[model samples]
Target: MSVDVFTFGLNHTSAPLSVRERVAVPGELLRPALDALRSTWGAAVREAAILSTCNRTEIYCAAEPQVVDQLPAWMAQFHKLESTSLQPHVYRYQQNDAVRHAFRVASGLDSMVLGEPQILGQMKDAVRAANEAGALGTLLHQLFQRTFSVAKEVRSQTAIGANSVSMAAAAVRLAERVFGDLDQANVLFIGAGEMIELCATHFAAAHPRGMMVANRTVERADLLASRFSATTMKLSQLPERLADFDVVVSCTASSLPILGLGMVERASRLRRHRPMVMVDLAVPRDIETEVGRLDDVYLYTVDDLGRMVQTGTDARRAAVVQAEAIIETRVQNFMHWMQKREIVPAIMEMHEASEKVQQAELERARRMLARGVAPEQVLEQLAYGLTQKFMHGPLSALNRSEAGEREQLLELMPQLLPRTERRR
Candidate 1:
């Protein structure tokens, strides 16, 4: 069975947040998930990597053709969901199409926020996890190596990322819409991950009246807070001090909602229904969905921010076109490499067979010499033997073939065989 490149997953465009969150494999679970993927399919899954982020949960694998269609079922089973529940949202690509999809995804062409750079980093992280899990093999390693190269080329050659409205910037804009100016509003950041750090950088530029970082780990929170000259707080302190902030931006890897409706509702009452802006960038969502219903709270999920960032992207359309062109070329190149790889075993077998034929002819020539045969005659016989052996398979095949196949072989024989120079 031939192993081909296969990609299966659902992104923001294909699935809602509700469905996405259910299948999201967090960073901590990535290796285990990859191991599960390989085990479930056994040898059918030769190599695998899972790229799960806030906007997508993609599994890129080098697997047999028969295993491609069953990937969705495996994903649903791993996530403890019914296959039917995920069937409508999932998308699959094979061979060249899969290569193109991977190139587009890494280049940020397939991202929720077009030209966003975060997905590339996330992809790299996923690759690293796959490597550490021993799930990476030659095919996937080469695919991602080319993926990163293509992404770099696209960014340098196109303006896809120029003047890009990042989610961090969008969060600040959302807050300003609620408060008009961040300079007078107190901003609170939840979690100390990269997204939170990015949000802090943007919000810090506004120089909010006060800034604070709350995380499960005080050390991490303190480290992030020092950069923005913000205070650090434990997550336990959020409820008591939640009403103190006018803006809250949260992104965490927690499997469940960190801020529930009851917590935010009480905080809203404590603040006398004062307007507060909240941004939740986590996949499963750090903040409760019902919090958006509160009269005093303005809550935005990752999807909401994705929509907001998509606006005013007309200027980047030309860059997108250029980037896609580059990606398409790279995809073709990668697929060509994969095709060559598929024929390698046949090429090796042919070499081995030829070597065996050469050895047998050499043995025959040595035996003829040992029996006192003429040296020149033995040389001529050796040459003849090699030539005859080389031509035997093709000649036999041509003879066995009927009219149509014989005609095809006759046309191909000249190219397949080496020719001697003709006398001038």
Candidate 2:
């Protein structure tokens, strides 16, 4: 099978949430989507895996090289989106470039929040799901295995992750920008998911005046709230309690907007135009876009937080130089292994040819012994015959050749012989 690594997707860089959400593959639908991709494209996609988080959705495949060209079309058809809609936003990488991209992504270099460790786990989960679906093969398997090792190395050797501001941390930063310090801010979190939990953790570290977790399930909200010594409520209660908080951070999986413009306007009126900082980390966006226009409301999306988090990226430029050196060396080693593997079929063919020569000469010697030749003489003749047969073609060619031809053959003879014989 012709094997290649290819990656294609859009992320926080190439597209906004409006574009991203249209192509975001829900975890429940991932397997079916993969199946559809494989079936739609057939043999071109021999093995495939997808990593679809809120920040990015990427397809990694080990297949025929031509599939790289077909991916955009496949994605458009599968998502029921226009080709133009995806073409402007997608990035594609092939072969070593794809491998490097996968490694960087797993290592968090490609993250919206650089060097964040959560993406590595999310990638692992994607690989595991692909494995369960029988879509992972030697190429993708080795790619991900090395990707994890590279990530581990980057974390252990570099300070890339140090002093990094996570999305949750950035949400807190944006809140601080509005409220000066979070100490007096009453922080309200929407959703009891991992994102909300992480935001709650970071906001709690700021020692907010009050913290509350709101979710569809009050029990789950209460469960997460207890960890931070915060209170809990149902999502239904948010409209009434909205004005009570000075900061709201939301990341939920709801298909529709959870916090609408009217709701925030009402909350602003309730608070008498007191400024409220709102951060929407959700894909579809829990908060309405028009809410950002409200005079008393400061609304930020994940992209806004992403821009804010990029502030100290220049500081990490030194560490990036060092990390790139390590990754380059590893890439060369992996490419070398791949190069060696490519020659295996030719090596096996040469070995089979040599075995045939050996077997044919042995049979000839056995026939001489069977003809009643003396055992010692038979052995001597066998050795002589084997030597002559091996060298006959080259020696004959050398004898009939001109001066330079004979010189080259004589030079090669020693190398053609066994080591001990050549030394003697």
C-alpha lDDT of candidate 1 relative to the true structure = 0.93
Task: Report per-prediction Cα RMSD to one decimal.
Answer: 1.2, 4.2
The sequence of per-residue lDDT tens digits that candidate 1 reaches over residues 223-290 is 99999899999999988999999999999999999899999999899989999899999988888899
Query: Could you give candidate 2's per-residue lDDT for residues 117-206 as a string of tens digits?
Result: 889998998999898888888778888899899989988999878888889988887788778878888989999887888899899889
Clashes by residue pair, model 2: none
Candidate 1 lDDT trough over 10 residues, lowest sum:
175-184
- State candidate 2's TM-score: 0.84
Model 1 spans > 4 angstroms off: 422-424
Q: Who wins the TM-score comparison?
A: 1
Error of 2 at 358 (Å): 5.4
Inter-residue clash pairs, candidate 1:
none
